[model samples]
Target: MYPEPMSKSLEGKLVVAISSRALFDFEEENKVFEDSDDRAYMDLQLSRLDVPAKPGVAYPLVKKLLAFNTETDNRVAVVILSRNDPVSGLRVFRSAQEANLQLERGVFTRGRNPYPYLTSLGANLFLSAKEEDVRAALNAGFAAARVYPDSAVAADRHPDEIRIAFDGDAVLFSDEAERIYAARGLEAFQAHEIERAAIPLPPGPFKPLLEALKPLQAQPAGAPMRVRTALVTARSAPAHERAIRTLMAWNIQVDEAMFLGGLEKADFLREFEPDFFFDDQTGYCDTAARVGPTGHVVSGVKNEVGGPRPSDR
Candidate 1:
């Protein structure tokens, strides 16, 4: 066996923080809480304590990510940070064990929000089923998303290849152009993009996570499937130049870039069939979730606490 590395500070490791619901199917239990009460929900969860929870939308993506840790030097950590009380947490641990997920750390905050502990975990990404918690995580300066439970499970094509897709603005780049579009519409946003074609948008929360993947991408060719990435943005034609140029300026090369303007991403994503997809808008997130593993990046101006819903626009 290879000697494992031990790092107290998580140095040289990619840490992911996720909620129990995002990693496992909790719709039935959540419905119990909504239809009756928390006490009743706890009772149900307790009764089924030994039963392993079914995998949720993020399961395939997490499984592929954990595969990269097959070597001792390559480190990837996933922690369960959930609002589930300690009593209900017994099932969560049992489920992870049944799934063979090497999760050893978690924070059970009961009814309290758990976003505050994300920093302590040195998390590069946070995924949960709760929109409020995701927004809180983003506001706290972490790459976070709200996973949709109804998303289809990922296809295991190219078992060795791990492909991930990301939205350009808001999710990867700052919400700069998104703010303009929200205020003055698409025409203005396009003109602004043309004007700043040479200027690279500032990095968004996920930039760190993307940068972290660089080392993994550099692995030897003989290694089992490597990581492949794509940028699927809603910007087309003139506006697309800025996003392309920005990535060039950053010296990062994505395997593919789809510039779909005002088109429903669900069908397009259905064809691409990525392990996961992340977007800031709820409409896209909700739609894509039905096709495959998806995460709702909740950052940018549109998600402001008091702002109107993006679907209203």
Candidate 2:
């Protein structure tokens, strides 16, 4: 009898599922797709098969994450989970090869929602340009965000380091306090947080992704790549105490924390130069996108139909 084949697994690895549009600059082809149909888009991609797509907003972040992997140590896995057809997938794989991205797996749904595959892939994070897909992933209890395609490219200041920034409520922690703030006001929210300062806030959708990064962050000093995380939140003073204490309770350590209160976060993001920043409020995301790559976490009360605006927060 033949020997049993070795089983393949992504155990203990950080798995990221990224859409093609979020991974490459497919805006022109996407326009063709939107204006025409799948056939036209496939035809255009086929003709440009030899051409490599430019890096998108999330390229820098993906590149740095992949750097965690080594010949002997496979620390990360990035799979292309996109809506493009199999034909267009050729171009994506070709472009990744040209860009030196060691991506080897993908799933093409040809315009269908691909969030369901996240479960089988054991994905810790999912980034896509489609809000619907992002919502589905988050609803399914996975970390997901809608990428801002037009956002500025990441800065080259920290080429070897991956810097990620996240908002407090909704993005990292449950939006319980945010709902209180929305229904009552900032004063009520602050009071609630103060009352629960000793208690750790519940985990949000992105908490798992943050936890996955903890091991990567603990790598030895000689590792080729490093990760730096920051919390840039609108909460100030007493409210900040809960946020800090929450991380402490979870045993997660962030490199920096900025309690900006209600001040604009764009300027602060520009100075921090994170590879990507995530927030639940579109208004804050819109402004932050101008500085660097940003993702909109479509969770929490702030994202509801009649939710309060960023200015109100």
Candidate 3:
């Protein structure tokens, strides 16, 4: 017998579920809530309902991404999966309206874990400010990242290009090498890469998301905006060969690749000026955030988290 068809409403679309804090600057109100309580926060947001919040780190990325939906048959869907109570979510919608963002759906968890809903949403990627939520999302098999509020906001570097960067080990690939590095030291890590250069490292949390992006990357040549991915890793020289070979093994292509070894990535990211950058280490995110939007992958040995969990991919 033949199988059932897919849901037309969501068939062949890239769905991204992001949080309010990740999409808009809720730092001030977040401070209020943290210093005080939820009641005070809700009151503040309701009082300032007419006031629009400023764009946060992922704002530009979202705006550019939504631009791809101009076609009658939409190719993308973005949902606001925020932890804010439904009441406070008003401000989020108001801000999205102020920015002329065409967002239409959301789920306000009211301080509860929002990761479970990602499965029902069929989310290809989830972005949030809460590390717990991101971790939960990843554990549940969805691609998730913790947005750094302190990181640089998205810039109008190139209106027609969607530039995204990714870190190597512990991010695009499994933390196996990271495990060796942490157990021993940098010397051991380099040695492992050299020895296993021909062996492709296991896939990491973002591999599913990267695979999903391939078809989107193949969009028409002159589409208003196109995705240009880059591999910005800390591995340099002999270590770089393995990474290149690994991508070749996976049959994936990155527009540009940078192997910075041990150098600080902020300056390099500043030059690349990606709309968004994902790294497993907060250090890179903190520094790179100053240049452009950034997200922290809360996975692998460095994250003090467990190995890849079985999930949706």
Candidate 4:
């Protein structure tokens, strides 16, 4: 067996914090009635706890964090939970402990306060706090939006990390949908989506990025690898052809990919876990951030464009 690494201070890498709900992908049985008190908090973070998750499902998230941590020596999966919710908090911490997850001390909620726990620990917490936090971060030129209310405070914890994730298609790829929308309009875009459902769409804008990281992939972890990447797109099976092709063309490999069809992406994201998940749509990012961290990829389409070509992004 490989010797377990000692838990040392996470000094230089990015931390992708996740909640138990996302870490375990709680089963349907864990579902709580929407009427519960925990389901109606002002910050919206507490309300997400009603969703149930199992610790066993946290393997991937743990493994990725371990790999990232081992390679770059800067990765940590700080499991953040509210001390007010002791049962869930204990469950999350124990699960990580059993897996020997390289966790930066567990967080026990600071209420409306932003204590910057991850910052003090030298790892970033990829989340935001309150709407003001989002607005202020964005206003201050930090990539901010109403990511996930529950984990919004995540940003408050770690502000230095790039903390980015991606959804396939329009986000990382060109605005083909917007292109189709311009050429044939909304009906055409929808038609293209349906037609391309099996044909697979082309790569998104970030394809070049993945290609750039290819060399890094060859460099083993702990040797100073920057950026943690994943694919949290809603496409699956036959529809996933284009995403795979794009990566192949660009020669970029992602750290992870979850094909969830139309199921709540947040459910799977809770497990793969990310600092921020970028998607063209708001709902996916909204739900995903609840479990981990999420972001919206702004479209940079030119208005007079004659539609997106394969080489566009």
Candidate 5:
């Protein structure tokens, strides 16, 4: 029932919008303590217990996108934050104000401090949030939002030009192998992929998304999806067969694939100039952000301490 994939030419050209959770600091209410218990609940909610701690953990994904505004010359990004700021929050208001000041110096970052702008930030895209985060935001009286631009709208936005880039494993495929590499070791993961390379790999996590883009893909190259899809991943040749096969079996045509084999990907990305780049790994996102508009789709895992999770931590 989904729409077809977008055309090759209309891949990554469009306004890209991202989100943040802190826009301004909340004014702490004075409390007449009837008992110590009253302070306990208040502290948990308002987080007034820690002066240095922020109101909300600034989602590293947001920072990654913000970093894009600094480097990549293509695609505009608008960052949205919650109006109810958290003390431990990522200083969303300060960042916005500062980014505003830098704007005169030619810094072109966009800040959506007053949450309402999210729906109309020229891109109309919201980010993916964990179920718990979405619920908590709503439960705590914050607005529940989701990324807009279903395939049709995305196609319409760039009907004549789009350049999409996908990060191999997690962003395009399931994280199963990625989990294996993390849990068991590269040797074991590589062995598993070699064993099943001929069996035909399952559709990726975003396969449906690719299928939905088929319609857009069908149009003439000059009309949409100007470039065929590109897959960028850390997997090398022998370990990358399944990824290629899976796309082939799905009848998905990828214009390019770069197996980094531990090399830094930013250099290659700069040449590609993708309007939007998606990757599940923070390492790739960090570097790619310097080259283009990047989106780090949040997995359900709450290892979210803010910034890239330390590999050792």
Candidate 6:
């Protein structure tokens, strides 16, 4: 009998699964695919096999995350979980190589839903340009977001740090308070949060993603690569207490917290210059994207039809 083959493991590593479109600037090529059929797309990609595609919105984040891995410790793993065919995948891998990314694993589903494989890869987060795949991953209890293809790329100011920002409701914590705000008004919402300030809000979809980042944040000072996180929210003053208390209750610490109380978040995000920012409401995401890379977390009441509009937050 032949001996059993040994399977490689991604255990004890933070695994990120990203779509090819999210990792590289395939907009032009994707336009061709959208206008034509699969054969045309494959032929175009094969023809440009020697060409290295430009970096996409998520490239800076992925590049910094991969820097955590070292010869002695492989702390992070980035895998291409794409919907392109095998033929086009060659260009994707070539792009990553030319960009100096040490990506080694990928799953190309040929225009099919690829989120199902996230569980097999033990993905801590999934970023894609397709909303359907992101929703599927979120429904399956994985942290996922849909990247805006036209969003601005991250600034090169912080070369060695991976800076990320997230909204409070529906992103890091449950949207229970947001529901009350939607049905009632700001006064009622503040009253409700003040009443329950002692109670920690329930975990949100991206809570696990934040928790997973704690270890990376804990890397020793002067480490080659570091992580910084922020909580940027519309809740201010009285309502803010609950959000802070919630993080304390969960034993997670964010480097910065902005309680804008419904102010425009773009200016603040521009100053912070995050590699990526995630918010449940597309309105906030739209503005933030103007400053830096942004993702729409399509969760909570704000995203529902006829629910509270972005202004309500």
* lDDT of each candidate versus the true structure: 0.85, 0.93, 0.86, 0.48, 0.47, 0.92
Top of the candidates by lDDT? 2
Score every model by TM-score: 0.92, 0.97, 0.92, 0.42, 0.50, 0.96
For model 4, the superposed segments whose C-alpha errors exceed 4 Å read 1-164, 178-205, 221-228, 300-313
* Candidate 3 wrong stretches, greater than 4 Å: 1-8, 305-313
lDDT of 3 by residue, 1-313 (tens): 8899864465477889999999999999999999999999999999999999998878898998898887475778889998899999999999999999999999998999998988888898999999999989988878789998887664677999889999998889988887777777778878989998999888888888788788769988988889999999988888888889888999899999999877888888888889999998877777787888889998887777564332110
lDDT tens readout by residue for model 6, 1-313: 9999998899778999999999999999889989998889899999999999999999999999999988988989999999999989999999999999999999999999999999899999999999999888988999899999899985476998999999999899988998888888889999999999999999999999988898899999999999999999989998889999999999999999999988998989998899999999888898888888999987888777565574647
Which lDDT value does model 1 have at 209? 84
Candidate order, TM-score descending: 2, 6, 1, 3, 5, 4
Q: Candidate 4: deviation at residue 12, Å?
A: 18
lDDT of 2 by residue, 63-118 (tens): 99998988998999999999999999999999999999999999999999999999
Collision count for each candidate, in order: 0, 0, 1, 23, 41, 0
Query: Where does candidate 1 stray beyond 4 Å?
Result: 1-7, 308-313
Error of 1 at 162 (Å): 2.0
Better of 4 and 5 by lDDT: 4
Position 173, candidate 3: lDDT: 90
lDDT of candidate 5 over 130-248, digit per residue (tens): 23433333233232323211111111233334566787765577666766676667888899899888766654444554664464456554431343468888888688898888888
Over the stretch 163-258, how does candidate 4's per-residue lDDT look in tens digits?
A: 346777665566565566555654565566666654435555445444533443555454433455778765656546666666666557777777
